[model samples]
Target: MTIRILLDTDIGPDCDDVGAVAVLHALEKLGEVRIAGMTHCTSSQWGAGCLDALNRFYGRGDIPIGTLTMPGFLDGDSGYAKYNKGITLGYPNRYQTEPAPDAVETMRKVLAEGEDGETVIVAIGPLINVMNLLESEGDLYSPLNGMQLVSAKVSMLIAMGGHFPAGKEWNFEMHPASAAYVVAKWPTPIVFSGFEIGAPIHTGRSLTADLPDTHPLRKAYEWYVGEGETRHSWDLTAVLYAARGHHPFWELESGTATVDAQTGANDWKHNPNGNHAYLKAITSPSLVAEVLDNLMTR
Candidate 1:
């Protein structure tokens, strides 16, 4: 059976996000998963545009794309706005555009209509959308929290957020309150792809080099890769794990993650809460290289 997936991404900040989307498209072609929706949680307008471009590139333009009402981080001008302008200038009408919807409504509708036990939520951005969904419409659904929603409607949540033993990841830090709420209350199995996972997997190398100039993935990468050259593929790793189930380098653990109220540190414990899945560590280099190579070529 194909896994139905909802991809929540903040695509533009780093080039790896585009790479992640590319990888996801490849997985869809292989029939490993069916993308139910794509939501953007970043402040980058360019990111949203990039996502639209990507969906159109793969001939999946009908896939719904939702943007966050507010930006997650404050990096100069909003990333979402910047991305929007950039992508509009670059691709023009290469993709469709839609206003951001109520995320809770979108998730509820998607999960309700999807095949039971075949859905997975792969989050590569902040937990705002998921958190909002839980806060507003969670009780209406079977699961009262994001975690519970996962356990009930999803097979698993392969998230590209949070740091494992350490606690300084950008996604977690961007919205600590939401992260705390989610990690503590979510019910389904979770596999966390953290900052460390992407460290060894650097971009601006083989993946871009191998792609032809007309390739959409290459165009997206070219826009984001600047300065120091290589960028982290944080989101792509989560996508890989979700599509492939197991990569050679990742080590999984069943545990509950508790966010420190003061420091925002995520402390994962092996208590039998029956509501957590923690990715303790990853075999960074091989997994990153393998995923990137596969995405660039395929």
Candidate 2:
């Protein structure tokens, strides 16, 4: 019953993506997940390196990471890379170099290496990689093209961007065309961790009180948004559901989620034929916070 996960994230700017990675590793440690690979849609040179440090901190430095090296593809620096240097000062790692294999190929390679219908794609970033994955043709990994390959291997899509019922968010805003395209034609069932879903579940405050100063997550959070402030838990919610799937936590709402191509706004419509669903708040934010902090702290 081990779940294979291909995580796609825009990690540096927001510390939640870091938190999402933490939870992924924690669950992996518990034998609930096997991280297949990580793909970064962010354009920062330091972004991939930061994730490498975290994975290494959790004893999984060998995990494959994909990066978007092309210019203007939501490229920029995440100030949180400042804390990553701390991890490298004491450990050896290969994340500092420019990312290789490119994101699309890296994902294809990850999927190709996995068993059919076992890999789950969890995206907590922009839709850049999703668009590319679907539009891409067959490569050295498999004879199947992008959509076909995904339909064959990946079980579902769990994304962490968008405000339900027609509102714009950062991930969708960055690439509306891609967002719209992905929601409309992606082959598997999709579930969203909406803005409202995780908006109330504040985190980071607990780490400040419980974790040691040497802890990388504590340091990452401290450097990213100061010592006391708590941020919303949007990305973390997606990671939880991706592994647990509304189990002891959430109630699932069935429907199709749509994005406006021009504005990146989203709306949900019920269709038995639709392969989409969005999270409906079930368990309280406090319970979610407790579960997330417990996993992240471990």
State which candidate has the highest lDDT.
Answer: 2
**Model 2 CA deviation exceeding 4 Å by range:** 76-92
Error of 1 at 164 (Å): 1.8
Taking all chains together, each candidate's TM-score versus the true structure is: 0.85, 0.94
lDDT scores for all predictions? 0.68, 0.83
Report clashes for each candidate as comma-separated counts: 16, 1
Query: Candidate 2 at 174: error in angstroms?
Result: 1.3
Question: After aligning candidate 2 to the native by TM-score, how far in Å is the CA of 10 from where it should be?
Answer: 0.3
Candidate 1: tens digits of C-alpha lDDT, residues 1-298? 6778998876655667777777888888999878998877755445555677777877887776666667435434543343445554566333335455545666766776676677888888778777776665354544445444555677777777767765678777767787777776665667788787776777656645676766666665565664325666788778888877664666676667787544556776775654666554546486567656667568
CA shift at 210, candidate 2, in angstroms? 2.5
